[model samples]
Target: MGRTLGVIAATIAAVTFLTGSQATAQQATSSTLTMQGYGWKLTDIVGVYAISPSETYTITFETAAMKARYAPYYTEALKQIRDAGIHIEIGGVEPVDINQCGPKNHIQVTERYRPVGTPGWSKGVPCPWQPQGLGRGGLVIYNSEYWDGSWYISKANLHNTIVHEVLHAMGLNHPNVDLDGDGTVEPYECVATSYGNKPIMCSPSGGYHTSNMGKLVHFDVSGLKALLANARAQGIS
Candidate 1:
C-alpha cells in the first residue's frame, strides 16, 4: 500500500521573527541548502528564509470550504519539502478572484472539479518564471464543478499537485529516466524499479491513465540532482 507521510508543522516560533536589518544580514550570509533524497539532489537559490518569510508562494482557492479541506493536504506536502531541506512557509488558503488571475498562466478548474466531462474543471498553466520564459509560473485554479463529479479530486492528488508545483518553482524538472526503454516516461509511474511507472510530474491526461488521486507519485531524484547541479554551476545556489 502507498504510504501517506505525516505533516510537519512549521517552526515559526523557534527564532525571533527576523526583519529589516536582521533579515538583510541573514540573506547576505545564508548558506546554500542542499537536500539529497530518493537519489535526487535539490538546492534552493534564495534559501529558506526568503521563500517562507514573504509567503510568496500563495494558494488562492475557489471557495472557503475548499480552502479548509485542502489546507491539511497542503501542509503535508509542504512538510515533504521541508524534509527535503527546502524551507518553505505556506500562506493561509484564501478565495481566489478570477479577475486577479487575468491572463496569467494558472491552473484552471472546469466542470465543477469532477471528471473532465463534468461541469467543473482544473488545469495548470505555465507561469512566467518557467524555464526560458516558456510557459511557467502560472496559477492553479480549482472549481467545484470539477471536484464534485466523476473523477473526484482526492487528498493525495491535491497534495501531489502542491509538491509538483513547488518543485518547479525550485527549478526542478521531470526526469528523463524511462527504464523500460519505451522512449517515454508514463505518468504516475513508480520510480522504485527499472520499470519506470507513471509519475505525477507527467501530464495528467497521459501515461498510466488512472484517476488523479490514485496515481502513486514522488520525485525523480536524478532529475532533481541535475537541477541542483545546474544551479550550483551557475553560482545561483
Candidate 2:
C-alpha cells in the first residue's frame, strides 16, 4: 500500500469524470475494505498552499441554487475530513470565476452543461491550475444535466460525484487499477469491499449507492488521512 501511495509524490494533475448510468463499470475483486494509491499535491510553482492553507479553504457556490442543492451534501462528506483532523471551511453563495484561480483558501463551485455524452467533469485539487500567487483555490463545475433530468442518474450517484470532485479539488486522484487483471486500467476500475463498496474517490463515481451516497467510504477517508500524513511530513502541519 505504501508503494501504491507513492504516486502522490510525483503526479502533477488529475481529472475526475463521473460515469454515466449507462457506462459499463467493474469493481475490484477484494471484498475487504482497503485503501489504494491516489496522487496528491506535494509542491508546485504556484505554491502549495492547499495542504497548508493560511487559514482554511472556504467552499463557495456559484449561485444560491447550487448552494441550496449541494452544500448539505458537502457537509455530509466533509465530516470525514474534519474528523480525520483535516479541516476546511464552508462558505455561502457567491459568484465564481472558473477561468481564474480566485482568492486564497477558497473553493469555487459552479455548474456548466457539458456535451451530451459527458457526465460530470472536474479538475485536480490543491490548486493544480494556479500559475501564480498563493491562491489555493480551485473550481468544481457539476454538469447541469444531472439536475435538468437530461442525464438520468440515481440520487446516490449524483451525490457521490460531488464528493469525488471535492476530493479531487483537495488533490486526490482516481485510484484506478487493473481490477480484471486485463493489464489495462480502465475508468471506475477500483477496489471494492466484499459488500460492493468502492472508494468514493473512484474515477467514475464508485461509492455507496441505494442507501446513502453523501458519506465518504473508508477507502476515501484513508486517502485523506494519507494526504494529511504526507503534508505533516513535509512540515506543513
Candidate 3:
C-alpha cells in the first residue's frame, strides 16, 4: 500500500504555514490561493508513458475500441499536463479482462502498475468511496462495468474523467473542498454552473459540462495550474 506519511506531513506543513511567515508569503503570491491542506503519501514513482518525445504520459486502455474512443482526448489532455512540467508515464494501452473490474481486480492492477518493492494489492483493496489511491503513482482502472451504460461515461465524460483522475493521481484533492480555512468548498448543483463554470473537473455529475462554444472541455487553465502547483509543492514529478 502507498504510505500515508506524505499526506500527514503535507497537512502538518500546510498547517504550519497557516501560522507563520509562510502564510504571509502565500498571501503575497496569490490572493486567490486556497491551500487544500492535504497531502499524498509517495507509494510509487511518477513517470511519463505512451506518447513519444518521452514527455507526454498515456493511459493504457483495455481494448483497441476503448483506445480509439479515448486516445484523442487523452493525448490532448496529456499535452496540457506536460506543458505544466509534470511527466506522466502511461503504460502501453491494453485490454483488461472483465474479471478485473471489481475492487480486488483493481488492487491487482495497482500491483502491476506499482514498481517492484513498492506497496501493491497486498495493502488491501481500496475503499469504494475513494476510487483513486492515496499514493504518488496512483492507478485509475476504467472498466465498462461502471461506465458502460452511464451517460456520465460519454466521450466527453471520458475526457473529463481521465483528466480528473490524473489530477487525483497527482495528489490534488477536490478543489470543491474548502482547504484554505474557507467555510466550504465550491459545490456543484448542476452541470451548468459547475467547476466554477470552468470545465468538467468539478462538474456536478462527475462528467462533462455544456460550453458556450458547444465544445466539451475537461479542465480550465486555472484549475489545472492549481493542481500542478499542488503536485509540485508535494514533490510529485
Poorly placed runs, candidate 2 (over 4 Å): 1-50, 115-126, 129-135
Q: For each candidate in the order shown, give its overall lDDT on alpha carbons.
A: 0.36, 0.58, 0.35
Candidate 2 vs. true structure, TM-score: 0.73
Instruction: Give lDDT tens digits, candidate 1, residues 83-194.
Output: 5443345444444433233232233221133322323234332232222112212334444443445445555554565445444434343332455778875543334434
Model 1 vs truth, CA RMSD: 12.2
Point to the candidate with the largest TM-score. Answer: 2
Q: Is candidate 1 or candidate 3 better by TM-score?
A: 1
Tell me the lDDT of model 2 at 125. 45
Return the candidate ranking by lDDT, descending. 2, 1, 3
Worst 10 residues of 1 by lDDT: 1-10
Compute the lDDT of residue 13 as modeled in candidate 1.
Answer: 16
TM-score of each: 0.47, 0.73, 0.43
Write one digit per residue (lDDT tens) for candidate 2, span 107-132. 77777776222455434344543322
Candidate 3 stretches with Cα past 4 Å from truth are 1-58, 63-65, 94-135, 143-155, 178-196, 203-237
